[model samples]
Target: MEDSGMRIGEVAERTGLSVRTLRHYDEVGVVSPSGYTPGGFRLYSGDDIERIMLIRRMKPLEFTLEEMRGFLDAVDHPDTPGARKTIALIRAEAATRLEKLRRRVGYAEEFLRLVEDL
Candidate 1:
């Protein structure tokens, strides 16, 4: 194992994702580890961890795996006009979803208050 890279287990712990989930991400080619140990263990660098964190954020916003790949590609090439357009579209979609989520949470809170009143 390289001293500069963290093992998959460490990445999972830090990212709050299961080893299985990380493996799935790797298998899907959404996020590949930066290095591998002599024993064939996966090792992730700081940039890999940052990318995983971005994936974690997107999951809650209901971004699909394919969408993730596209978004990451755009992130990697932010200087391109096409990438800029992709980012704009995704950001708009995310905003809409977050607004819907907030409304649902408001409803849930109201229900909880009514139940407490009883």
Candidate 2:
């Protein structure tokens, strides 16, 4: 797991994700902490934080939890044939989404400029 000793609160603060959101991600099995204190506090690793960040990035892409899980699994097992296929599809979809977001942002900037001129 290469787990870090960082607690859940630290992880939430560092990742800009709420504590409840981190807990929910744990509950949903999207990203579970790699360790726990004897007092029952959740502890996260660096890898766990990276995984959470990946999930956060995917949120703007409107990926469902299942899709996030699949993507994570694919990342974890890139050598698998199915994982490779999933990665290919997700990569293409992400590029398309990025292009769309760029276009939308351009429109938004244009609107803001017009509004500012008034």
Candidate 3:
């Protein structure tokens, strides 16, 4: 397996992702493994690990799977002008998500205050 690639379980452990979640990502064409072993186990390379990390970062920003794929595609073709546009879009979306999270935190604090008053 050393010459081939890391197994899915190993990748999950290293990436802190559940096996089911990794499988789902593969199923959804979000982060397919680099290859498969003779026994049909998925093999992930360092590049795949980096890609999964990117997806993980994007998840908190609420990027859909399709959007994640688009981002990954842009990353793969960094020379394209569209890559710059995609990154700008992702940054804008992240700002929006951050604002929503701030609002939710404020609402949670208000709820806590109401409970304390009671």
Candidate number of the best lDDT: 1
Candidate 2 TM-score, C-alpha based:
0.92
Candidate models: Cα lDDT each: 0.93, 0.91, 0.89
The clash number for model 1 is 0
User: Model 1: residues >4 Å from true position, as ranges?
Assistant: 1-3
Tens-digit lDDT string for candidate 2 (1-118): 3344788889989989999999999999999999887777898988899999999999888889999999999999899879999998999999998899899999999999999999
Candidate 3 residue spans exceeding 4 A from truth: 1-3, 109-118
Query: Which pairs of residues have clashing backbones in candidate 1?
Result: none
Q: In TM-score terms, which candidate is top? A: 2
Per-candidate Cα RMSD to the true structure, in Å, reads: 1.6, 2.0, 2.2
Off by over 4 Å in 2: 1-4
* 1 versus 3: better lDDT goes to: 1
Shift of residue 80 alpha carbon in model 3, Å: 2.6
Count backbone overlaps in model 2: 1
Error of 1 at 44 (Å): 0.4
Write candidate 3's Cα lDDT for 36-89 as tens digits: 888788999999999998898878677899999888888788888799899788
lDDT of 1 by residue, 1-118 (tens): 3746998888989999999999999999999998888888998998999999999999988999999999999999999779998999999999999998899999999999999999
